[model samples]
Target: MLPPSVVKDRVGRTLDRMTSQNIDALILFSREDIRYLAAFDQACICLVIPKEGNPTALGLWLDIDEARRQSWVQDTRGFVPQYHLRIGGGEAQRRRLVEVLIEKGLSRGRIGIERGLLTLEMFDTLKSGLPEAVFVDATPVLKGLRIVKSKEEVELIRRASEIADCAMEAVSQITDVGRKESDLAAEAEYVIRRSGGEVLSKTLVGSGKRTLCAHPFPTEKTLEREDLVYIDIHPSYKGYHSDLCRTFLLGRDATKEKAHETLVAAQRATFEATAPGIDPEQIYKAGISSIESSIYGRNFLELYGHGTGLNVEEPPMITKGCREKIDENMTISFFQGALTMPGSYGLRIEDTGVVTKKGVKLFTRYPTDLLR
Candidate 1:
């Protein structure tokens, strides 16, 4: 859980952005945005944040008690859902949300909504309920506020990265010949859970030829000698996520060993290119230049990386054509890899870090060397 002051600061920044954009109130639909504002972590809950008043949270009757206890908002309301409605199950709930908005004197004012997350049916219902109110897309405003991380948020991300490191260490110690990839993945997840961290994404474990694919899931395939194995772990603490990936080898192979070395160099170049006042596109170019200087350059993939914080992928993307400048206290995940050829083994190295005045401060500290 975050401190009261930290939560207040987050809400204050959001309110400031809303004022600048002339938005009277914001109706949040995504769980991430709601949790970030009110510290509530439940589903089917709607949050209404006014520009100058205390925020309100609307939830089901069964979850109102928990919402009141967990969320920082003072005005929490409950509504009973009528499942008998065949067209839409939550008509009653939606009507309650609109009623609350109107009661708050926002019926004729401009309302901000998450267009990407809202369903077409819900949008229609809201439009019909508040015909005078103008609905404006607030996705950019929300993303702008969330792009920079505060001191407390950075600490949570650091702790999440530490948990990922522990899980990867467990993977390195328990992996052996003839062991199933699924078994290793399960062990890694257990390690994260035991350390009081939640698994944000599936624990990806790929070995041998399966490593060619970027996002392969663990399978029943048995490990063999000289096979290359890689694992990607995403774990979270207090809603802050960390992305980490590392590669290993069952036995020694010169070609794969060289590729691992090149990938590490590319990752280092990316880290060196990251700092305050630098464009993210420059960082991506630096990484590509470093990779192309190696023998495995032609095998490099196009996808680079992106920002990581409340969500696994966020703003200030580290890719081509992104003109966003990297600012201090921004957290980003850097990934660079290469496949020798189609259907052939590959190697990748990724880590999460925070941008600083000088350079990036890495959170994931697991060794990147290919395991023998």
Candidate 2:
């Protein structure tokens, strides 16, 4: 659940985006955007037509319960309910959506829709149903609105980080030298659900060298005495997702002291380069340079970190060749890892961080070391 203030902020920003772009009405269907503007959590394709006077949201009749519970609209009781076709093609909702627009004096006004995520088929359906209204693409408008984070949204992200931190702490305790990758991952989810964390990204614990594969699913591979462990965990708390990763070693001699020193140096360099107004490319290079000059080879995981928010992955990536300016309240991750570790072991460490006026705020507070 999200704070009502956050939902309102999102809706207000989206309305401003639509209004400034000269959009007559907004027909929101994207799941993320829908949740952004209104807290609609049902798994149905909903259409939201916002007019100058009144705004109407349309969804499947079956989702009325969920829509009512989630929507933060002040007058959702006044919203028109329409039933969607089970076949996902033609729906009674489409006709009613158009009819509601016509009633709201939008017969000749432009209807805005998120174009990037919507399909051509849906566009055809909307156009066919509302032949009188002009359809205008609103992808850029919505993105521009969402790019800046409000204080409420920022608080959600911070709360999400605390929940993710609890989950990782559980994993740190349960993941021993002999635990299987699958067991470690399953236990991660166990703690998350138990701690009231919403599991958005699938939990994965890659043991030993297998951790090098970035998005590897859970495996039955058993942990080794000298293996490296990387846990990729993303959990949603208060409707905001947290993306965090931690890599550690197992047994008494999991990683050599020299290797640990090199990685610590790299991580420090990356952290030093992180700030509110630093160039992302150069900051990423600061960390990668330590790896290349170390005993390890040139490449070690592709980039440093990506932005984390509603989605685990987002733009404003902290990677080389990215020319975007870093701003305050922009949360990011720093994955200072060594996929190119000598002796064929994956040693990667990641943490969620936020850009502040002075430096980055580290969210995940767990310690990084080889499991013994």
Candidate 3:
């Protein structure tokens, strides 16, 4: 749970955005947005935040108590499904949400919504329910506000990165020949949970031939003496996420060692280029130039990195043609992965941190040297 002041600050910023856009109220259905504003995480929940006033959260009866305890909002209403009525479950929920908006005096005003998160059926329902209200897509507005992190949010991400470092250390200690990839992944997860962290995504563990595929799930494949192992971990602390990736060589090979060196150098260039007021394109170009300068010049991915926060992947994507500039207090993950050839092997290095005035403050501090 976040501090009440932090929650209030986020809500204030969101409300200001709403006011700027002339939105009488903003209805958040996406779990990430709701959690960011109200700190309420539950299914069948919706948060209605007006331009100027306290927000209201509508949740199921079973979860309303917990929502009240966790959420900063004082007005939490539990929805009682009217099963005996002719209305269906979806209709009932939609009607309840519409009623809330009407009571807030937004029935005939412009209301902001996450169009990307809503299904066509639900969107139609919303439109039909409030015929006089103008619903506009506010995804960009919400994402724009969330791109920057507060001090408390950055602290949580740092703690999450620390847990990721610990988990990687556990992996280093257990990675060896004859060990199953599943076993190593299990060990890492245990370390994260015991260290007061939660796994945000599937722990990526690939070895040998599996390393060729990006985003491969852990399998029963056993480690070999001469194999390339890749691990990507996403750990969260207090709803803030951090991403870390590292590739290790089971046995020494000059070619793989040189690739590792090149990868580290590219990541270093990215870190050096990251700072406030710098175009993200420049940071990406710096990384690409450094990678192409090495012997594994032809091995590069299209995407270098992305912004990180409540969601594992967020806005300000670090890719070609993206014009998003890095700003102060924004947290980003700088990563680069390459495969020398198809079905051969791969190497990657990723680090997460907060952007400072001059540079980035790295959080994941695990050694990038290829583990023997």
Candidate 4:
């Protein structure tokens, strides 16, 4: 949990943005977006931040207590029975939101909603309730606010990275010939949970032919000698996510060993080009160039990496076409350190880091060496 002051500053900044955009009120629907603003982690909850007054959180009656306890907003409300016992689905919540808007004298004003995340049913309900109010998409406004991390957010990501490192170490110790891919996944998840991290997704443990698949889930396939194995762990601490991957070989292979070295060299090149004011494509091209120079040149994945934060993947994607500049405090991932050869094997090395004045500071420190 972040300090109350940190949350307050975040809301204040949001309100400033709202004022400039002439948005009367902003309603956040997605759990990740709500968590970003209110620190309340309920998918059924909605946070309404008016341009003038304090923000309000609305949730189910059963969740109101926890919502109030966890969220920074004081005017947290819940949908309970007024007469007949009925907590109608999406419509009821939108009706409650409409009433709140009317009460706050914003019925005829411009309201900002997450068009990308909001349901059509809820949008219609609000439209029916307040026919005069104009609704605008607030997705860009919110994305602009969340692309950069606060100091506290960076610390939380660091802690999550540490937990991922521990999980990788645990997986490495237990990975051996005859062990099932699921077995290694279990070991990684156990370490993640015991280290105060939340398992955001199933740990990916791909070996042999399965390594060629993108984001493959762990299976019962048993490891064999000389098999190429990779473990990608997704863990979260205080809603900040860390994505890390490390590849290894069950036995020595000169070609694969050199391939791993090439991947590491590509990662170094990528890092060298990452800094404030540099284009993301420049960083991407550096890795692509390093990999293309190697014998395994044709295995380049089209993507370089992306921004990560409240959600595993977020804005300011590190692709060739993205127009956003690399700014200080932006949390990013170097995920392009992967090479794939269909029907044969694949290898990857990834790390999460933040851009600072000095350079790109990586959080996950698990060695990139091809573990034997």
For each candidate in turn, the TM-score is 0.94, 0.84, 0.93, 0.93
Q: Predictions ranked by lDDT, top down?
A: 1, 4, 3, 2
Off by over 4 Å in 3: 1-4, 80-89
Ranking by TM-score: 1, 3, 4, 2
Top of the candidates by lDDT: 1
Q: What are the per-residue Cα lDDT tens digits for candidate 1 across 43-64?
A: 7778899886778887777788
Residue pairs with backbone atoms closer than 3 Å in model 3 (clashes): none
Candidate RMSDs in Å, in order, are 2.3, 3.5, 2.7, 2.6
**Per-residue lDDT for 1-372 in model 2, tens only?**
457667566666766777788887887766667677676666554545574765556666566766777765543422334446222445554556567767778778888876666666666666776677798888756764554466777777777778778888877777776677888788878877887778878886777667767676888888777676888888877567777777777655623545666676787788788877678898789888887897654545554677777777776677878877888888777764555554466666677777788787787777765454
Q: Which digits, one per residue and each the tens of the lDDT, describe model 3 over residues 235-298?
A: 9997789999988899889888887888888888888988898888888888889888777788
How many residue pairs clash in all the candidates, one count each? 0, 2, 0, 0
Q: What is the C-alpha local distance difference test score of each model? A: 0.84, 0.70, 0.83, 0.83
- Candidate 4 lDDT by residue in tens digits, 1-372: 447788778888888888878898998877787888888976577778888877787777787888788877889887674311122354555677778888888889899988877677778888888899999988656867888888888999999999989999888888899999999999988888899988876788899989888888999999999999989998999888999999989989998898889899988888888889988888888888888998989876654788888888887688777667899999988874678776799898889999999888999999987866
